[model samples]
Target: MTRDAGRPVATPSQTVGPFFHFGLTANAALGTLAKDGVRGERIGLRIRVLDRDGPVPDAMVEIYHADAEGQYGQAHFDGFGRLPTDGDGTCVFETIRPGAVSTRADGAQAPHVNVCLFARGLLRHVYTRIYFSGDAALDEDPLIALVPPARRSTLLASQPSGEPAVWEFTIRLQGEGETVFFAL
Candidate 1:
């Protein structure tokens, strides 16, 4: 609220409570379209959404990864996927591994998926990347190298027990160990 002259004035504000999913979600999370019609080393991923207060249910996560050759816009793969969290604040994706991508300014980026997160209490969407944990090139990836060392681990996705090519990761939207968010 703001004071105008002698009386209190209304201030504009917005919150990501209940109504955001309607516009941004087009039943994208209802199925596994991201994995359809592609052939390569298939990988499964599970992401848990958390915040300072703990589990954040109904959050939406969108991801994009390059094809096997680190190229995009392929005839067989669209390179984009979207998923909404379950009541337990869990989201899953089944997509092929992305090859390394090169950037003129940053050199090369390790195999990873770009992600966007949307949920209640956020003013706007949060953007981040999910890098494969075992990548030897992770330390020098242009984007990963730019991030502070301590926080870089938050962006990595680790493989779970005995799950052949499956990976797991967690996203902390705020508070301690919050995941990094790019300005863009």
Candidate 2:
């Protein structure tokens, strides 16, 4: 007896890690409301925690910002929301563009969203602010310059989608692209 030569063959290989395919979960709270139905935008943030070896599933992400009109308050603004990344380690936030805030110093900060990251095994949560890449105001922003040149890139949010109004970014926990931490 002989086996058929046309039979499919099987090969063994290493399994792909979750980090490579991050953001594959559904967050109910972040879903959009409609008269007929509910739709949700996938929360896909490239989050990297500093000094951590791999993805932190328990990390809680929160973002606060104002609407397109630059209005933030109880009547117009909804408070912050908490979200956790899927096994792939990505969190999504349904937020609007924040208004430009004036710094204590001479210049003003560009319209930007604020991000807060909290995870297990960390003594304290990390605080970092994300800024738009092409905002003209960034050139003279004092806070943006406070970060060292080497680490400045990390603070920038990615515009992968190519929609200037909407933004995206990945936080590198280790290696290159690590976000800059603020003293406060």
Candidate 3:
């Protein structure tokens, strides 16, 4: 049987635009459950999400990580979170240091947080990894090893001068320090 002709051959992907804040930002205001009851060493991260010209004033951030003991996923303690950036394109996440998880390859993965970025003009969210400079096992991370040495620093968060357990990292969408995004 022949089908009707009036239809889109493929649905176009929706791009983030001028009004994404109304929905995603509302969730960010209430997304910090880890700030209160989780275990392990707590950490506060500050990040600036940037595009080619400059900072993305209204970017959104999402993260997933394992618990202090490397266990993750549960209704009671889901390790997922979302945060919206301020006008300065800065976002913060308060959570505990993620524990290392064993890989099928050979060794355990280094302690790190997985991040997803959403901002205006992006047709799809971008993915990246964040590693703590304070981790003693940082050098052994398999993922980090995959990146070139020169660009690897972009993935590691460093502690600020006077803030204990606080780390800083900037996400550059393009140009010189563009962050390395994973395919899947």
lDDT top scorer: 1
- Stretches of candidate 1 above 4 Å error? 1-12, 20-37
In order, the Cα lDDT scores of the candidates are: 0.82, 0.58, 0.80
How do the residues 23-80 of candidate 1 rate in per-residue lDDT, one tens digit apiece?
Answer: 6556644435345567778888888999888888778888887887888778787788
Model 2 quality (TM-score): 0.66
Please give the lDDT score at residue 87 for candidate 2.
56
Question: How many steric overlaps are in each model, in order?
Answer: 0, 5, 0
Candidate 2: regions farther than 4 A off? 1-27, 30-52, 69-71, 104-106, 161-166
Model 1's alpha-carbon lDDT is 0.82
Give candidate 2's error at residue 165 in angstroms: 6.1
Q: Candidates ranked by TM-score, best first?
A: 3, 1, 2
Q: Please give the lDDT score at residue 29 for candidate 2.
A: 71
Q: Write the per-residue lDDT of candidate 2 for residues 27-94, one digit (tens) a residue.
A: 55742211122122223334434334666655666666544444444454553555666555666555
Could you give the C-alpha RMSD of every candidate to the true structure, in order shown?
A: 4.1, 13.4, 3.5
Clash pairs (backbone) in predicted model 3: none
Q: What is the Å distance of residue 134 in model 2 from its true position?
A: 1.3
